[model samples]
Target: MGRHKALPYVHRTFRGWHVRRTWVNTGEVSQLNRARIVSAAIDLIEREGADAVSMRRIAADLGVGVMSLYNHVPNKAALLDGVAEAVLSEIEFTDDPSAHWTDRVRAQARSFRQIAHHYPRSTMVVVSRQLQSSSGVIPVEYALSTMLSAGFDGREAVQLLRVFIAYIVGSLLREVGVTPTFAPVRPDVDVAAIDGGLFPVVASLAGELVKCDHDEEFEFGLEMLVQAMIVRRGARASTSEPPESGVIPSPGLS
Candidate 1:
């Protein structure tokens, strides 16, 4: 009987053959998949703004061909969806059934805030797009279910969810200094240039107004909204019972 000989692995590129090594791990090769691609894209977005993210850049970062990325993500739009999902997955929903709905809402809000702050550069990318990924849907579904189980009607639940989303996105934008229509102006702009007599109050508080503690501001606003919603929930519950004719009269009318 003849002894069998071991085969060597060859590494090739478009230019030429690269270094050949034995004992290649197939498992390591399989690790480069969709999740890895999405993670690389997210890292690119985090290091540089979304504008800096591209298939070519990501491929270079991963030491793969740009065309190879398409096998995982169809296009930039799909890649962005993945990135959004990746960001959304950072929010963990609590499984505690005994937690109050308001507490759940607060937890979600805080989670969103922390994630947004963690990736300040990528916040715009995360918040600007409408998320359709499962990871994105999980937190939303959790919040909606909590609200519905807590006695909020479909319309009220949806509207309240929108209010929370809008508040958080707006707060994130302000915190990240990304204004809607223009670059952020320096806070150190001279306040004395403005006529003090014409805008006395504005001039007086300019210093305080310019300096913001995003965490404190977010918490204050969130607490106020939560308290207001709590009052609204109580009021809604009180008026939930229908009249004698099964037709409840609208308030503030005859």
Candidate 2:
């Protein structure tokens, strides 16, 4: 038998090879989604107020194209909503089921202040818009539920929740120097420059007021608000039912 010569195999080749597009890892892409965009916006807001939080600005901050942010945030309104949600979502609900309702209220209030302090400028986004999404509404729902469980009726609970929100938002805004309701104190004017002859009380207290400790002031106001709530709760209870044996009802109730 004659030995057959082995032929070398020739691999086929095509001209003009197209390069495969490189892609970011799934983990990286996921990390760069809504959360990342919202974080960048929050940073921008904290650094330069909410007015500086444009999609283009955030994209630039994140080193991405402006169009890339649209994938996560559709428009400026939605972006603001995202920022608001981010701010409100930091308010942690009370975890101890057996905690007193008043204590829970205090906890929520403190949590709100802490988060507001963390994102001082961005927190205005929370007050400027009504949250429609479930995630955004969780804090409100939790607070209302707490009020209702404490024996307040639905209407009372809703009103009380609104009052708490208004107070907290106003306090935080004032701390950030964005007082919309009244004239903010001009930091540039020296307290000693005020005329004691013209405005005696204002001049007298100017030193103390100008140098007041905000943390102490905030806690003092919070205690007053909590005490008022306690009083309201007690009044509601008094008016809610007949006096027990040997307990005389108040004149108004009687």
Task: List TM-score per model, in order.
Answer: 0.74, 0.73
Model 2, 1-254: lDDT tens digits are 33222111112212111112233333435445786787678878888888887888998987789998888789989999988876765554444447777677877788778878877887778878888975466667667877877778899898888887788878887776666322225556576777899989988887576664668877888877766666666676644544334434444332
Residue 226 of model 1 has an lDDT of 79
Clashes of 1: 0
Which residue pairs clash within candidate 1?
none
**Per-residue lDDT for 1-254 in model 1, tens only?**
33222223323332222222244443455445776677677778878779988889999987888899988889998888877766666553454447767677888788777777766666667767788766666667777887886678999999988898889988887766666322225544566566789989977876675565678888999988876676566667734433223223445211
Q: Tell me how candidate 1 scores on lDDT.
A: 0.69
Off by over 4 Å in 2: 1-32, 179-187, 238-254
As a whole number from 0 to 100, the lDDT of residue 48 in candidate 2 is 89
